[model samples]
Target: MQQHNDTIDSAASADEPDQIHEPRLWRDKGWTARVIKNEDGEGWAVEMIRDGSAEPALVGPWTMGRNKVDPKPLDATAHQTLVKTASEVIRRHEQQLHAQLNKEVSIDFGDDVVSVRLTITPDEFEPFGTLIALNPLGDVLATTNVRPDFRLTRESAGRWAADGFGKIR
Candidate 1:
């Protein structure tokens, strides 16, 4: 916990809006990159931290220094690269979460077509989803709880619509 707090503090210090320094592996705006010895003591690892975050956003192997034992020193280019990589990692994770939590499909509803959405709420204790049917005007026609892993496939949506948007068996 102290290590986490220290990391957050380091990130916050580096992220001060007015501060600017030559690129280095240590810290950048709202982010910090630090290299540490691996647990096994056989290799080095780098940790990327975001300001105000109690956990590292990314962690990966680090290159050996000239001593062939110590970790390489952080530099401007390496810091920038690590920041970009960490940002991309965050972006991809968010995209994946969005994809898993929200899904929609169009289906024929009698004379008109409507849309159905399955939005999962991933709770560690009680995972669930809300299967919602929307009319042409975007008004919700129905809503019901479903398994957290429910998928909004075309066949399932069509069947649900046909069944008056109750259960998507």
Candidate 2:
């Protein structure tokens, strides 16, 4: 839960000064932490993300962060590990998308062709909107959506156009 930019002790109810043994890498405005009280009045470790991004940033099996054996709250070590893991996860996702775009899927829209060439775009959110399509001779024929019509064959540009490829959005 987002408790306004703070990572609280999962096992401790009161904010008894966070025995900060080490510094955290993700100490940003978008990150937070909270202590989750379990049914047995136990505490569970959980992180919060209020950046309004795709996923909620949470940490731990919650109560598992606390040792049934130790009952200690989350620490610097665990938080650092969490940061690394989350960063790697997002990096892998972008890498996979780059691989997909660069893999080159040829679209046969009759005389027209579409190629999903990978472009080094600015580091930003997920890329969307229509991208241009160029031919082997570098000629512009039609502007289709990022996705091609699966039914359109290279030999059927006229048909694809008639069915609506270059129609102005």
Candidate 3:
């Protein structure tokens, strides 16, 4: 009987919206900072969670409260710091992914040098890549559909250019 009553109480609470301890420190749009108790029983830890994201974008140590016994409350200065750090983390991740998906190589074709690029477009339904050739003046010469994992190498680019931008064997 006790277990059944407890389950009913939890189910009722689950229907209610999330109740934050301090409403002023959190925002519905953009990113929000929350100060939580550390599991190590030491100090506090801050988590910066972006709106619509399931997990926190960044989490790190936080300062202690004035009495040095409890976790410090969230403040404007601390929230700003967390937002800056989380933004940098997201920026670096985007740059690394772009570098991995986009590749470029230069190959000598007789007297002129040609630039070959392989760009991968990752889509949930159908992922594909585009193999493009550009002249010295950065003008597109040819384009072809390629495998998403295509690699642009000097030998491969040379063969593609020599064959007039046909499918690579």
Candidate 4:
């Protein structure tokens, strides 16, 4: 096996069309795994970056070779594991963001149950939220715009319903 360094050679350029499989680098299945020296410690670390992304989605300590000096070589099994772990990290981040931007609640208004949903649109200048009320059958009852910081709770939703779904003050 050839000794490898952290930097990618010309043949393994990210822009190249062909996939690369090297001792320290593996680029395939839309992901690239690179073994690099750990800046914070004496050992080595591996980072998995998705294609077209500017940063690595996952980075962790790498195993040492039998010599206990050089880093272990990248192999098919290790590459697949790294890809799977990185993909999961991306998926979890997306789910957490979605939950933060969307909220929902159900409340009893008069003789019917109403479902209230608040969806927030984040912007650099002005962030806003939309509050929508739906009847038990999922028919739209009312819709209005509100500030992104608006808190949607059982008490607030009840008050909004009692006020005939007028503009929130």
lDDT values, one for every candidate: 0.82, 0.47, 0.80, 0.93
Q: After superposition, how far is residue 142 of candidate 2 from its true place, in Å?
A: 2.7
Give the TM-score comparing model 3 with the true structure, all chains together.
0.75
- Candidate 4: tens digits of C-alpha lDDT, residues 94-142: 9999999999999999899999999999988999999999999999999
Cα lDDT tens digits for candidate 1, 50-91: 877888888999998888977788886888898899889999
Worst lDDT window (10 residues) for model 2? 18-27
Clashing pairs in 2: 6-33, 44-63, 45-62, 108-153, 108-154, 110-153, 110-154, 110-155, 110-156, 110-157
Compare the candidates by lDDT and give the number of the best one. 4
How would you encode candidate 2's per-residue C-alpha lDDT over 1-169 as one tens digit per residue? 6764345544342443323332222333234444445445555545544345655445454544333643345565555566666566667877886754443335665575555332333335644334345566767545544432222333343444456455423
| TM-score of predicted structure 4 | 0.87
- Residue-by-residue lDDT tens digits, candidate 3, 1-169: 9999999968865764452336235432367888777777777778888878889888788778789977777665666677789989989989999998899999998888999999999988889889999999999989998888777899989989889888764
Rank order (by TM-score, best first): 4, 3, 1, 2
Could you say which candidate leads in TM-score?
4
State model 3's lDDT. 0.80
**Candidate 4 Cα outliers beyond 4 Å, as residue runs:** 1-16
| Model 3 collision count | 0
For residue 26, model 2's alpha carbon misses the true position, in angstroms, by 9.8
Model 1 misplacement above 4 A: 1-25, 167-169
Q: Which pairs, if any, clash in model 1?
A: 23-76
